[model samples]
Target: MIKARDALTKIKPYVPGKPIEEVKRELGLDDVIKLASNENPYGPSKKALEIIDSYLTNLNLYPDGRAFELKTALSNYYQVQEEEIIVGNGSDEVIKLLSEAYLNPGDNIVQADVTFSEYEFGALLMGAKVKKVPLKDFTHDLEAFYNYIDDNTKLIYICNPNNPTGTMVTEVELIEFLEKIPKGVLVVLDEAYAEYVADTSYPNSLGLINKYPLVVLRTFSKIYGLAGLRVGFGIAQKEIIANLEKAREPFNVNLLGQVAAVRALDDKEHLEYSFRENAKARESFYQECQKRDIKYVKSHTNFVLMQVEDADTIFNKMLKKGVIVRSGSVFGLNRFIRVTLGSIEQMQRFWQVFDEIGG
Candidate 1:
């Protein structure tokens, strides 16, 4: 076999949630509800769907390499200059781009131990060291993150309303943390689930971009329901964006994705409805967990991490019953399972299956 880069030895492949079709095929089930991935069950806006057909004829040509139209839309919406934004295949790609542009061997990145895995993956891929700070109260310990940074630290990833645990750092807390970060170190605020947060204290990360060496990542996947389209973007100071752009793949966002994302941004009704419904479903899940005396971390995102007697067993039981939830073992939280809050009807089905499994 050809010799691979030594960095591959340090990296573990990301295991995504089982798809609904894959579950049905493997288990011989007719129906399955997937709450494993934190995807918008409601799907994309009608306006976005309407524009897809019109873009079909142009598939023979490559998409605009810069994703000009979508960037313009985002610029108008966020009130940032077009030069300050970088569109990617997904925010996931933007993470990789940042790593490629900055990380070098012996350099290090700091992030919450149990937060999003991509931050670590990116660093490891570049042969950079990862310094993990344990979460305090299931939330990012900003103070501890500051302590982890030294001259070798090149990046810091803060997942607002962090993945798996769904916990958040307040605006005041984040601002304080940013103020303490050393100059030349880039702070990446991954806010993929920002639209789902009902908390008034969630930081306006976009507003802080100009003041700090910050990149705020947002996606059309969750709130705009364009996960399948694979459209995500990052907003930052033009200099930072220019550097990341150098490492980005040309035409990373597909043509249809660009058109759909632009139209999705215009669908205010769909955006509002999705946000309102997610809040309701999240609250309902919280009540259900409380009534059963199930321990759960309070969430700001559209998912909840609940403690169970045996998460692996519970996950398998739920899987067999046509419900797919993410076992927290992957994040090193062996006793918990992270479940995405679905629509009212889908969540009802989740509860029905969960109860049948004696969970």
Candidate 2:
């Protein structure tokens, strides 16, 4: 019999949002609303879906291992070279590749205490330690992060418009923080929710990737509405891409995901529509919170983290009412709950049940 590695014991697998069908079955309700994962409630661009449908007959062929067409499309859109881009199965895979390429035993990765869990899991998988600096006032504390860096720090993960909290580090703060860090340490800026950001204060992370030797991860999963296709890409210096390439499995991304991502990039109208809808609904959500006298964090992304005492109780209650929102206890923030912003009608429905429950 074989046992798992000691490092594997330190890692906990990620738990994604439950499917709507599962919730409906569990609660015995027909009107279930899922606002847990920050999925684009509008769904994918019709053109992208059509393109994917057209390519289904060719599933017998292996995917373009290099994802040439998709890389070229992303390169053209971002004004970066194709050589500087590396497409991933998802941005999740890119994080794992970065850890595989850079971390050695006992090295450390630094990130905010309650940001995305994948970064910590990536480091732990590589037999490395994670140094998490606590967030300040529900936001990334750049000064605190800078203070904690040491010689053994191999990477720093910055999730702009951070997960769970939906708070962002400002452009000014990010620029100053970048300048203070040394060259050898790679900064992985995860902007999976960047497209939903309406706040001008958020950092222009792509610009930093060009200026410094940083890696910027973006995904088709959010505003592009391609999460089911599992498409995402990273932009970095040519050397960084070359290093990460060593860890990638050829044909890691599927043919359908590549085709969908390429077409989605061309659908400017769909992209704009998602942006506008998220911004509008976010304001309404904030107003609803105000009306209820509930304390909530103002968000730059497509989700809001609202504070509630007995969050577990509220989560279970919401589920019983056919609404699925995330309980933040997994991130160790027991007092907070994260809800994805949706269309006006969907969000209005959420608040309706919220009001009925006297929450």
Candidate 3:
């Protein structure tokens, strides 16, 4: 019998949140709420839906491989050169592209232990080794990250407002870390939830593109509520962008995604509304945790990572109660869970059920 490469053994697949329909059917219940996966609970901006509806007729044609119009829009929005932008099916594609383009077997990728799992996934696909550095106090320890880099280190992933922890590395610390890293090593700063950051100290990662050989990734999946549409992009130096583009499929991003993302960028009102609601919900949730004496990391982004004894049990209980949050076991934090801050009403409902369970 044929067998796969040895590296396949190192790869653990990503398990996303179950669909609400699947959950309801399994539990035989109705009115399920999913706060898992950090999806925007407000749903997509109306303008995005309207534009996508208008573009439905064009679905028969292949999407623009270059994604020129969307890239142009992104360039104007971020004040970056058009050549520096590359659109993807989502940031997941971008991550895969970076690994494919840069990593060689036996090379190394580095990230905090309990952060987004994709960085290690990308490494394993390319037969590279992952050096897991433990986070400091639920945040990325910039010093440890820099210390881990060596001649064999090809990639270092910084998930700002990190997944499962909902904590961030500040701008000053990131700038210093970037400066200290070797020029040959690529820094992929995955700012997937950046739009929800209310903190003034989070690095403006795009600004670093011109100064260093860094790639800053963003997604419409979060605040723009386009996760279902699968739109995300990366900003890097022209040389680095060219390398990643080589690994990209001819039409990785679909027609609907381009249309939706363009309209979503223009919907400033929707953007502001989502940000405001997320900030408020984050505060309220923190207060709830405080009152209950539940330990949680203070978040600048749209989610909270709270410690509960037997998170698996609490997660199962919440599921049965028609609410769903992410168990942190996937990120190697078995005692914690990540809850996405949703609309005021949805958040209130989540807390209500949570109180009942914890009480």
Candidate 4:
């Protein structure tokens, strides 16, 4: 029998939120509002859907290994050269490619303690040491992270508008932090929820790559409503993107996802509508929390991190009500639960159930 690498032991499989159909079956309820995975409730761009259907009969052909058109679209959108962009199956895969390109048995990676889980997962996959610095006030502590850097630290991930907590590090703060980073280390700015961030304080992360060896990742899964398509891209200086491309598989992204993503890029109307709806819904969540005097981290992304006592029980109860939310024990914040923003009607329904369960 073949032996698997010992590194596999350190990797924990990601747990995705339960699908709507599964909840309906398990809870015996037909009505379900899924607010767990931070999906765009406004749905995908209509233009993207049309392109997907048009490309259906072309499934027999292999996808473009370089994902040329999608990369071109991304380059145009982000104002980066084509050589500096790398499309991946998802930003999750982009993280994995970075790990493959940089990490080794003796190397290490640093990240916020409570941000996206993929950074650690990718580090472990490459036999790299994982160093986690705790958050300061539910936000990335750049000073603490800087302290963690050593010669062995090869990569650092900053999940701006961070996951689960839904907090952020501002542009001014990020610029200061980037200046202090060692020249040998690569910084990955994972801005998976950037479009939802109405905060002017948020950095234009893609532009930062000009001065730093920064890899900025964006995903179609969130604001573009293409989560099911699994399309995401990363932008960096030409050299870094080239290195990542070496680790990326040929045809990493499917043909349909490529065409859909290109069309999605042109759907300005859908982008505006999704952004507006999410902002309005997220604000309503803030009002509900304020009315009940419940503590929650004010979010810049499409989610709210609520501090409810007995979070584990609350999670289960909310699940029974067919309102799916993420319990922060997943990120080691056991007293907090993260709720993804849905449509206004869905948010209203969630509050109705939330009020019944003592807020």
Alpha-carbon TM-score of each model against the true structure:
0.99, 0.97, 0.98, 0.97
> lDDT tens digits, residues 6-52, model 3?
88988877899768998999999889989998899899999999998
Clashing pairs in 2: none
Residue runs of model 1 more than 4 Å from their true location after superposition: none
Over the stretch 85-166, how does candidate 4's per-residue lDDT look in tens digits? 9999989999999999999997999999888998999999989999999999999999899889999999999998899888
lDDT of 2 by residue, 75-106 (tens): 89999999899999999999999999999999
The Cα RMSD in angstroms, rounded to one decimal, for candidate 3 relative to the true structure is: 1.1
Q: Provide the lDDT at 147 for model 1.
A: 89
Off by over 4 Å in 2: none
Q: lDDT tens string, model 1, 101-145?
A: 999999999999898999999999999999999999999999988
Best-performing candidate as measured by TM-score? 1
Which residue pairs in model 3 clash with each other? Answer: none
CA-lDDT, candidates in order: 0.93, 0.90, 0.90, 0.90
